[model samples]
Target: MTASNPASVVPSIHDRFAVVRERIRSTCVAAGRDLASVILTAVSKTQPDEALEAALATGQRVFGENRVQEAQAHWADRRAAFPDLELRLIGPLQTNKAVEAVQLFDVIETLDREKLAAALAAAMQKTGRRPRILVQVNTGAEPQKAGVLPDDADALIASARDGHGLTVEGLMCIPPADEAPEPHFKLLAEIAARNGLSVLSMGMSGDYEAAISCGATHVRVGSALFGERISPLKPS
Candidate 1:
């Protein structure tokens, strides 16, 4: 399955899913984790509906997108396309877009600030639906990133849970590209546990296997499973 439009090209969904399944299985086995514990979400950032639909056709219920605009245009129309599929916002939640993000997405995997958390809370009040969210952490503590400071994670998590809206599930982090990931992933899991949180959303296409081994409940993967998503879709 190839498409001239970058979105249409899904080299081999099954083959790709199989490789991922095998990787997930092996990682679970190696980590002494139940293979069913980790759920694989095919990140469909730049891919077309067909690509996502194809994955959904294969019984894939989890799908992720990186931008509010992209998710809105690319997947908002998908309520009927993949009704049972779970849609997640795997990117930073813009403060202004919190309302729409809450309305459209099942999960916002990038909740990183008190303001946005508050905004999502307000949004949920209007929509009568609170979105499940994970606080994004700048685990590497990079100045150029979007997550809240790793040290401040607790304050935000507490706020989210106490808020009238927003289900504070757990933490999400993007480690520095140059780092080993094991330490960072392990750190995220440990932090979540310490806070008594349940979900630890981390890792992407490249090192998710390691992320899973370290107890990542949700792995957001794209390029590896979808074959190097081309631009105008940059890796988030």
Candidate 2:
């Protein structure tokens, strides 16, 4: 664990977690918001089991997985080792995989369209398990992303509620990455408010603090909490 060793890591998992937690706390405090309102979803996409073990040692329970197949790959054999972990699928969900997703994820963060909603409804009915779902909104209007357009935020959630047969728990967004995320975060909060939505799931490793400042209910931290994902190209 010498500093110069190639394998030597900075910010022992405990230290990294403390930093992330403190960041959330200070950000929430400075914004005059309740720190407890900000839930943390450790984005565990492509993370190894040992790293997850380290995270668990620090009491990190909720984790976010980007793909359904990856969840099946990572958690299937090792999840029981950590009794506290709750896995959630936080990426775009395919309707065909709805059944498998329900069995593995405690929450689905990407219920975007009517067909997907209907699929989740049918899957939940057949499986007899309903998961908390957050309507994903493309608040930043980035074309390359997967969320619903900003103008349709409320309508999408309504469709999930009326068409999906599941609880419309909240709103989740991935703001444009290259610029300041605060404005987009604030807009998401406003959208949630306008629709009387209770949960706001915005923020990531870079701008989670900003998101918290603007009333983000959940922050997905990966690199800041865990190390940089082995390869950034993959969803985190």
lDDT of each: 0.83, 0.82
TM-score of each: 0.92, 0.90
Give the least accurate 10-residue stretch of model 2, judged by summed lDDT: 2-11
**lDDT, candidate 2, 32-103, per-residue tens:** 988788899999888766677677778888899999998898888767876766887889888889999988
Error of 1 at 96 (Å): 1.0
RMSD per candidate (Å) reads 3.0, 3.4
Report the alpha-carbon TM-score of model 1 versus the true structure: 0.92
Worst 10 residues of 1 by lDDT: 1-10
**Residue ranges of candidate 2 with Cα displaced over 4 Å:** 1-11, 78-83, 232-236
Enumerate residue pairs that collide in model 2. none
Per-residue error for 28 in candidate 1, Å, reads: 1.0
Tens digits of per-residue lDDT for model 1 on 1-236? 35644344544765688789889998899889998788888888888666776676667788888888888887767688567878888887778998889888898889888888878888988888777888888899999898988789888888888764568888888899998998999889888998898888888888998898788988988877777865774588
